[model samples]
Target: MLYDLFWQPFADFAFMRHALVGCLALALGCAPIGLFLVLRRMSLMGDAMSHAILPGAAIAFIAFGLSLTAMSLGGLLAGLVVVLAAGAVTRSTQLKEDASFAAFYLVSLASGVLLVSKWGNNVDLMHILFGSVLAVDDMALCFLAGVASITVLTLAVLYRALVVESFDPEFLRATGGGGAWAHFGFLILVVLNLVAGFQALGTLMAVGLMMLPAASARLWARELPAMLAIALGIALLSAYIGLLLSYHADLPSGPAIILTAGLAYFASLGLGRHGGLLGRWLRGRHLEA
Candidate 1:
């Protein structure tokens, strides 16, 4: 029974194996970026950027007819445009950063839907909005793995700058200009990972995998290294269990994985040691005793 439920799907089907690997890659690549996003209080930013890349992919689809390279480049360009425009506005105007991000997110999402509707078929639109991980081939797996490697390497270089910027940007700025470059480089990493993930998980659901695990880990951990470890572990577990759930229940792979991550988030919320409700209750009982 255990073998049938837990292990047979991947053994029987290559698609399941591919999807399992792809989801793991996505989780690995997205966790650190997501954690930093939460640390910087930019949880919504991931969602915004995910949608922000859609129009670029849509344009590429219209022009290049479903060419992956074109769509990837277009999406990267589009994401960078929004990031630059939003950052520019935040620096130049009275608008707060979240508001700037929100404004661009709405415009980009609406425009993407409109463009895809006008030029592409419903199938194309669905593919962009909700990617099919089950369809991931070896080439796609390579892309996801490559993105993960690049993200890990980039974060290692940017680690000190980003952490310092997160806790004390002024201090980092006082020392040198590394903070500025680090900030920009971090944003680029965010967009890069989002673009890579969007191809497998869809724009809407990609950030779910990214942000949910990080947020959940935040409730459980206080230190950055611990948080990153917990988040990556949660993402990987969710990917594996979610794929199994999808296989047995005939559910969508992306949403299933995200839902599993959501389950983890809620579980963390209730039972986390940092400030979870259950932990607080337990502490109260101990005090009374």
Candidate 2:
């Protein structure tokens, strides 16, 4: 029964094996970026970038006829454009950061939808919007693995600068610490991971894998390193269980994974030891006594 429940599907199908490997790579690569997004209160920013990248991929598909490299480059450029334009607007105008991001992404999303509608069939559109993880090819797997490797190495190299910028940007800048470069570098990493994730989970769901696990971990871990570790672990668990649920329940793979992460988030919200509702209520009751 245990083997049937857990190992049978993967053993019987190559696609399941590939999906598991892809999820593992994503959990390792995207979770840390999601942790930083939560810590810096930039969850919405990730969402906006995810949406913004769609138009680029759409254009690439329209022009190059489903070339993965073209679409990835297009998506990367679109994400970077949105980040730069939003950041510039936030710094130069009275518009706040989130508002600026919202403006750009809304425009990008609309444009992407229009482009997809005009140039591609519904199947192509669905592939871009929801991904085809079950149909992942060797090239896609290689790309995913490469992105994960690069992300992990880059984060390790820039850990201290990113930590300082997250908690104390003013201090980092005042100390001549190249905070702007660090910030740009971080944003680039976010874009890269999103582009990589887009191939597996679609743009709409990619950010969920990153943010949901990070948010859930935030409820439990007080320290940065702990939060990153917990978030990665939660993400990996969610990916595995989500795949199992997808196979058994006949659910959409991407959303099943995201919903699993959402489940973890809600569970953390209520039962977490550090900042959960139960913890708060317990402290309140103690105070009353």
Candidate 3:
């Protein structure tokens, strides 16, 4: 029965195929970035940036009249601007990083919503909020693919510096690598991923995909590489399974995908041997004897 439901749709429909491929691409691109974000304790920054893209998207719609390419580019630029501005503010002022991020994103979010409301295009807001993967066209797919490739390549080249800076910026500075710029570059890549993911996952949950699997991987792995590999594996698995479920169950693709990733996170929290709650409980019981 399950095979009939799943295989028949893929065999018969084009949209399902697009959704599956698109989601997989998103997972591959976003998961590794998620690992670094989690390690750097900047998960909330992802959330802020996701919301911050709204106004840019809204303005793009108003100015360019619903050109997806224009809107996406505009939103991407907005996200990068916010990231840089946040950094500048944090460095030049007394505000902490989190405080700066919160202020910038909240203001951006509110401005976007207000502008969209004023422009009388509330319908587009749904697309900005929840996404519609089934609506993805060949152009969007190609764009996502390019963004994914660039994101993965950038991360690969900068992996060592990012890892070092994440763990110990002082050590990196001592080694004369200019850890600050490296850190800045890493965040720029993250902002790009968040922008790319906005189309597939939307503002409400784009960062969810970027954070949950990496968070889950942390339960079992101590080293950064192992954690990243495990996170990527879990993310890919979630996308495949979630797409299948969405196909058979006729659910919204993005949220279904996110829920699948969330389940993996919860399972890891419970069953992981390193620090999982279940593992700890079992060890305690065993030691009581």
Candidate that would win on lDDT? 2
Q: Could you tell me the lDDT of residue 115 within candidate 3? A: 83
162-281: candidate 2 lDDT, tens digit per residue: 999889989998999988887889999999999989999998899999999999999998998899999999999999999999999999999999999999999999999899999999
Write the residue-wise lDDT of candidate 3 on 104-148 in tens digits: 999999998888778756677777777777887898788878878
Model 1, span 87-186: residue lDDT tens: 9999999999899989999999999999999988899888999888898888778888989999999999999999999999899999994998998888
> Model 1, which residues run further than 4 Å from truth?
285-289
Q: How close is candidate 3 to the true structure, as a TM-score?
A: 0.95
Listed in order, each prediction's TM-score against the native is 0.97, 0.97, 0.95
Against the true structure, candidate 2 has what lDDT? 0.92
lDDT of each: 0.91, 0.92, 0.84
lDDT-best of 2 and 3: 2
Error of 2 at 45 (Å): 0.2
Worst 10 residues of 1 by lDDT: 65-74
> Which residue pairs clash within candidate 3?
none
Residue pairs in clash, model 1 = none
